[model samples]
Target: MTVQLSGRLQAIADLVTCRAVLADVGTDHAHLPVWLCETGKIKSAIAMDVRKGPLLRAETSVRLAGLEDRIQLRLSDGLEQLRAGEADSIVIAGMGGILIRTILQKCPDRAASAKELILGPQSDPDQVRRQAQNLHFRIDREDFIREDGKYYPLIHLIPGEEEAAYAEEELFFGPCLLRDRNPVLKEYLLRRMRTTGQILEGLKKHSTESSRRRAEELGKEKRLLEAALNRYEM
Candidate 1:
């Protein structure tokens, strides 16, 4: 039986360009790796998760897929147990952006050795992009998908010289996504605009210094979102 992945997970898997070996970090059910191997997209895979329960689930999935020989399961915290040059590409998905950033930070050398990175952070994508930039990974591609009333951003990064700089808007809204004028990105921005507007409305009720300061900051953010939205028109 072919393994089916959710839309978000499929988006993450589609970003995997490395055919030799791919490492799936925090692979809860090992679905991605099994799918990749079953489809002949990758020669081998190392499915690593921090928790034993999830790792066992991944193992079961791998075995059910009849990919026991091609996929290796491991329990690792981040990339601590992974060595440099072990895999051609690494995927860290379905985790908070801060935790994803921490994983990359904790294993800079190992991360740098890989040819590419496919990241899908559940939150704070800006932090993930900023950290990737600092680590000299160029943002190659970014795609947005709206699944089950949630927007998910998938980023593809490759080793390269550090980018010169990124505008605040570019950092928050992915640089490639903005440049490409992705329609889904516009949808994501519109949702943020609405949320921020609601926050601003709530802040207006209170005139304290802290509330006032927060209002000012959010006001700037709203303006930026408006400007970004405007780009779609022109």
Candidate 2:
């Protein structure tokens, strides 16, 4: 069975440290697990989701791939269905950063038991990075991908002693990703540059304290984009 993943999630999948059993949280359609199985990278995987419809969709894919025995389909909310050490690694993708942080925070034990975590947050990436730091999960790698005119952030985190405090710039623009900036990453930075320029322009017409703060933020973002472009590959 050949499984296809969105370019962003495919990048995230590439960062996963393959283990005996992988659990994909919010496994919509279970494409990642199916891909791992087809590639023989993992012995088994659990495709878990909070919604039944998606779980059913994953079920269909598992059956189509003749992997029902190897892939387990479960209706689970966050990590509720996951017990400690159920899998060597966990992947939470295609979700917002806040929700992903909540899932990890609520199931610290479960997260701690896993050897690693691969997260691909669609939004609030800075928030996710901050929460990961707070949780003592060291980020081993970060990858950037753009698909369908949107940028995605993939982080590879694992258990370990806390490292040096991360700077605000590191949180907003990943250190690894910014340094290794590929063509897609360059495009993403350019998009952010344009967006921040627009925001700064809008602030000029709005005369208020909030507008002033926004203008300041836009300035910071513009500088960050420039630094990223200068320091990273184009």
Candidate 3:
């Protein structure tokens, strides 16, 4: 089977470091596991999903790739079905950050046992980062992807001390991304600032107390975005 991932998934797959085994949560089509196994990056992988439909599809993909023995398919909610030390690297992606964080919180032992946890959070990346810290996992690195007009945040976390490796704002944005002045992140901020500008302009047309409060909030956000972009400036 020839599994070609989207650019977003390919980026996540490229960052995967599977020395022994890999467990893919929310493996809709098992594309990542199939691709990794086909490329010799992983000898074995467990493709799991909360729904039976996806798991069935994943099984078909695995079988077609001639990796039915190599890739195991399971119907699991989050990481509940996985046990500690069973997988060297675990990937929980293509889901909301809250659900992702909840999965980690619910299965700390399974999450902590992995050498690496590759997270693809669709929203609330900051909350996920904070949760990872609370679970004794530090953010190893971060990646930002803009695909099909949507923003995706990929956070790679490993079990370790929750060191002060990031400032408050870095946690909100991303430590690695801001430190490197990533062009994608800068563009995301610019887009957000522009939207806030438009909202503020609309708020100006209103004279309600709520509108005033919203304008103030957006003004603060605009200022913060500008300050973050200032670092990227020469």
| Candidate number with greatest TM-score | 1
Better of 2 and 3 by lDDT: 3
TM-score per prediction, in order, is 0.95, 0.90, 0.93
lDDT of each: 0.90, 0.84, 0.88
- What shift in Å separates residue 115 of candidate 2 from its native position after superposition? 0.7
- Candidate order by TM-score, decreasing, is 1, 3, 2
Between prediction 1 and prediction 2, the one with superior TM-score is 1
Worst 10 residues of 1 by lDDT: 161-170
Per lDDT, the best of the predicted structures is 1
Error of 2 at 209 (Å): 4.6
lDDT of 2 by residue, 1-234 (tens): 557877776786788776589999998888999988888888999899999999989998898899999999889999989999999889998889989989988898888788888988888888888877766788888887767767888899988855577766678777677756666777888888998888788789999999999888789879877887886644
| Residue 167, candidate 3: C-alpha displacement in angstroms | 2.3
Ranking by lDDT: 1, 3, 2
Candidate 1 residue-wise lDDT, 57-154, digit = tens: 99889888889999999899999889999999999988899999999999999899999999998888889999998788999999888899988888
Put down candidate 3 lDDT per residue, 1-234, tens digits, no spaces.
488889999989888876679999999999999999999888799899999999888988988889988898988988989988999999998988889989989999999899999998888787788888887888788899999999898988887986566665676688888888988999999899889999999999999999999999888778878777877873
| lDDT (Cα) of model 1 | 0.90
lDDT of 1 at 68: 90
Off by over 4 Å in 3: none
